[model samples]
Target: MSDDEGAGRRPKKQRPFWQELPVLIVIAAVIAALMVNFIGRPYVIPSQSMEPTLHGCTGCTGDRIYVQKLSYYWSDPKPGDVVVFVGPPSWNDTYRSNRSSNTLVRGVQNFFSYFGLVPPDENDLVKRVIAVGGQTVECCDAQGRILVDGKPLDEPYVQKDYPWVAGQNAAYPRGRVFAPIKVPAGHLWVMGDNRNESRDSRAHTSDELHGTVPVDNVRGKAVFKIWPPGRMGPVRSHDPQSN
Candidate 1:
């Protein structure tokens, strides 16, 4: 074909940047929303509650984790899964009491939270599931180990340097030595690996559910840690059955 004819068949000129910007922005926003709402979201450890297993200490860079939102839809949370959830009302009262009450600051934080750049909710927490539904959970057997359904758990993940103890003055004072309690239906008993610092279900025994978190409150399972290149990998958990 002649040069003139070939030129006429060429692709149309690209749109100007100004005109394309809004469309690109909308597309980006939609993709981010879908990923954060349905697929997965990023969450930063805001406290040292999870310590040696998932660092989040003062003056230290916390671990950023990716939470998979779809898996729980296929199956209920199993014992040993590291999961995240909105803190129960009673739990939130203690944990989020210091969260900013300023609407403007909260608005900005919520916007970023939607993309998993921060925690999805200020009151959301992460912990390992110790028992589910009707299982009985208690701490500190003769060996100072957690027992589930009358079987002692073989937890290699509990922070060891920080010893586990029982009684009112123990590291996990509130949860250190609790009577065996049966988890109600659709509830989970969760605890932090850094038992010494975490304020998990064990710390709220006086609440209506007796410290068990409702299954519906769970957001998802934390599948991996994706921050600080040096500390990036899958988040591991021990199987109760394996014990």
Candidate 2:
């Protein structure tokens, strides 16, 4: 063929849609998986872990928080982050295995609860952050004072009626000072606003562990309640050290 004829001839075009179909589908699947894993996740409050701060209605109904999985990307778990984390060692009955069959079923129930498929359960306790790591969180003083880092923690989240007393227990005693731990490098000392009822770091990790929680265990901070229209509000970081 002459060079002029060759130049005039057009090259056959390669079909792209079919050739790229498999790769495109794989990419799409990966994106979907990432979204489900990180972007937005659904969780059910299965027990009275947090109270007052959040309440459950039934075997299915309760308050919901849209956890910002990426929120911590720019920051670390702060002192006042109302967080949803998997429980560690269980000394009291309040601890629930996040992976157990019961909780798994609860997750499924929560999926349908939004559509009125089931009643919301009050098992999940929605409480405020009382004390963070490194700070000294004491119950009550001689008169009545809850101190954090030698300064009193003005806890308005505690049950309005049941007032907080220092070392109320004879063993611990009222007005007793709870020593402060440096919070370690990656640990946290979490407490429920409902001090008396919450079996948090104060009880479980005390003595042996001194209520200090490892930072790695934290899942995400409770930023907002997305369920039940009545209790809608933003979850602020009460911890001053969450810096």
Candidate 3:
């Protein structure tokens, strides 16, 4: 057939945008998933545990943070690094689901969580690392300070300490008193800046691991606060031990 006859028989037809939209969406989703799983992910602070460092208040918009997963592959978590981790089994003993009870609503929330729109359904928590493997940690020297390796930590970040009510709990009558615990290797003892309000390692010392979280359970290091225009800044990672 002649060139003109052949061209006329094979007319170019552009596909409608509606037909291409799904392909584009699927591609975008795949890229987002890879980044969230391997590179880093966003997390919303769920409580006042890390107050002053990361804010989370009930009935209010919590600070959204960017957690870097790449760093831990080369370096283990250090003291004072704010981290997000899966709670130890004992930590979640009274945990309750936050997702809607409706099946369809829960399913929808799960789908958005993959893209970091909603928080994960698991019992994930955030706290500052106070002591690492092999360190002896305890609370309340005469001046009321946390000790690591027998050195009192000068923690200026702890602005609010929960007060000890007289006769509340005999074991912790001084509010932050705990017997010196030699942290097990490969675990971390973490706490919150809001000392009194936080339920941290000190609260779970009776557990099998003695309230220490395994390093493997840490998801990532919280590097920056990305939500709430007024609170956008790097999450503080002060090494209290250095002082």
Candidate 4:
């Protein structure tokens, strides 16, 4: 057929790269948001609370972790799961959102947050579930071990123990101590591996919730450590009570 005769069947011209880039970015952002919100997400440890297991400290790159949101769809977080959760109101006494006050800047930050370019606007923390709903938790028996349901937890993951000091009238050296606390239904008692420096449940016992985190606050279970090449591996969720 002559060139003129084939003109009507010619393929359409493609859009310029600049013209399509925005659309491509939006599409990519949508996919990432869905994955983060429903399937899983990557989080950067911001503190040393979960030391030895998941490393992070001021001026450190911190361990980037993968949190799986799917498992909890059918099951509640139990003892041993390394979980990411929002700090309850009383637990956020020192937390301040870094989101910009400018609406446009905040929107941009929010957009980038889906791609892990910026942090979330929540006081998300990582800790191990020491006790779950309807359980009694307390610290220090004859030995310096946390007791859950009146049983001592054999927690090998604890890398550092809080320093011991004599109470005003105590007969012996003691670390932080609290009376047996019955965890309310639908809540959890979580703590960090670096007991010495971690301001976890033990530090918040005086709060209204008595340092118990609501199960609803749990974001997901931390399943893997994916940052700092040498430390890449599965994040352990060892059940201290399994023994």
Candidate 5:
């Protein structure tokens, strides 16, 4: 057992840092892509529209939600499930109107959005599903409540700025007088918990498909609020009717 014996066995060579760096980077890219495209990704709430359920107003850091992308692969987005989706063209128009006009600035924002590092796509929005395809949805029934399939939804999560003042038409215009409209096939009727501020399905009724969003546009279901520690918890799924 001398140098002559060792010479018979080739010495192992370690990979150079440069050679290994590319592999490491590719592996990381793959993992990040998989998580963002298939597993789950963090979405920052960018508006106060969802309120108490999700904060995004001035002076309040937005709530960060983990959207489970796989949830819809097994089943469709059901009524009462909170979800995120690509905004309709009309929505995008409105959102883009206020964003930076410079292409460079937008490029940076888009890059961050791709990784879930900043708020989701400026065109993405989160809201609760009030009714699914083929269901009839209307607001108010002498009680100023939202109804699905003629049954009042048990929505304890709704955040109203003022007390329900029944018979006050001005206070509940959009929330109270919506005609019983049927959701189209492969579409969803979504509304924000903060009914008063959200520009959801109700605001786009003039569109060709009324205000219902195409199911295909849905990104994922938000099953948990994972930010601000104190507010971290499983998001509640409401029942269509009160027991």
Candidate 6:
């Protein structure tokens, strides 16, 4: 056959944008999704429950962080890890845990809510960790502040406007918590950086005389925030930074 005749039988040239572009994009998105869903995630701050450190009232006052789920795979939840968990009890006297909610839905939300993908639950609460099991956390400072391991903590993240003042007012009128009472082998004592507003383990979980959270109750640690461009950053412990 002649050279021109053979050339005429060849296939037509493809476009600059190959038809496979869609498939490639889908694959890339899937891989990214896998990394986000199972490897790391972001936690959104819904309310002022975790104020100062994480202000969520003024609009986009939250963070977008790479939450390492694998951290808990080897070690237990530390005293400073801002964990995301299911509230076993009604945190506020005005509200209670909804009964109709499905565990499956709750679990899914917990996984993707940080990516602006979905919300874990309408009642989710985010608070700072005050102490782990058996750590005595008392509000004995004349200024209504807290101390750990006999050392006075310095927290710059708290609301300066409400700096734990006690000179004019009674200190810890709510009552002093004599901790280090052995928070069970599998429990932890968590609190919000904003001592006055947070209804942490000190208030609700202590009714049973056990000032700690059970290991089973902990869902996972909040490593970072992925929402509110301005309020995005690592979810660090207020104790260490100040101390």
- The candidate maximizing lDDT is 3
Ordered by lDDT, highest first, the candidates read 3, 4, 1, 5, 6, 2
* Lowest summed lDDT window (length 10), candidate 1: 160-169
Candidate 2 on 1-243: residue-level lDDT in tens? 899999999999987998989999878767755654466444555445466776653475766676657876676676567776655545325533333268778787765444433543323233344555555565455645556666655545555224435456455532233544545555666766555555666565454556665555555667787777887887666554322
Candidate 6 per-residue C-alpha lDDT over 1-243 given as tens digits, one digit per residue, 9 for 90 to 100: 999999889688776667879888778767767765567555556566577666655475454444566777778777667776656554445455433388886676666554436644445556666666655665546665566655555656656334445454444335333433445666766666666566666676456645456666665677665666665667775444245
| Superposition-based RMSD of candidate 2 using all C-alpha atoms, in angstroms | 7.3
RMSD of each: 3.5, 7.3, 3.5, 3.3, 3.1, 5.7
**Leading candidate by TM-score:** 4
- lDDT per residue, candidate 1, 25-113, as tens digits? 88998899889989888888878888788989878789989999899888889988999998888887655443359998878877877
Report the alpha-carbon TM-score of model 6 versus the true structure.
0.64
Quote the lDDT for 53 in model 4.
94
Report model 5's TM-score to 2 decimal places: 0.85
lDDT of each: 0.82, 0.57, 0.88, 0.87, 0.81, 0.60
Off by over 4 Å in 5: 1-7, 16-18, 97-122
List model 3 lDDT by residue over 73-155, tens digit each: 99889998999999999999878987999999999999988876677888889999999999999875656678999999978
Quote the lDDT for 78 in model 3: 97
**Would you list the clashing residue pairs of candidate 5?**
none
Off by over 4 Å in 6: 1-33, 58-66, 90-116, 149-151, 160-181, 209-211, 238-243
Better structure of 3 and 6 per TM-score: 3
Candidate 3: how large is its RMSD? 3.5
Cα lDDT of model 5 by residue, 1-243, tens digit: 899898899889998999999999878877777788788888878888998888898676888888888979988999888999998887666665434579998788767555655554447899999899989998776676778888877788885744666777675555446778899999999998987788899888878878899999998989889998988988777855543
lDDT by residue (1-243, candidate 4, tens digit) is 898889869698999999999999999888888888899889999999898999999998999999999999999998999999999998888998879999999999998887777888999999999999899998776666778888899999987875544453254323367789999999999999888768788777888998999998999999999998999999988898777
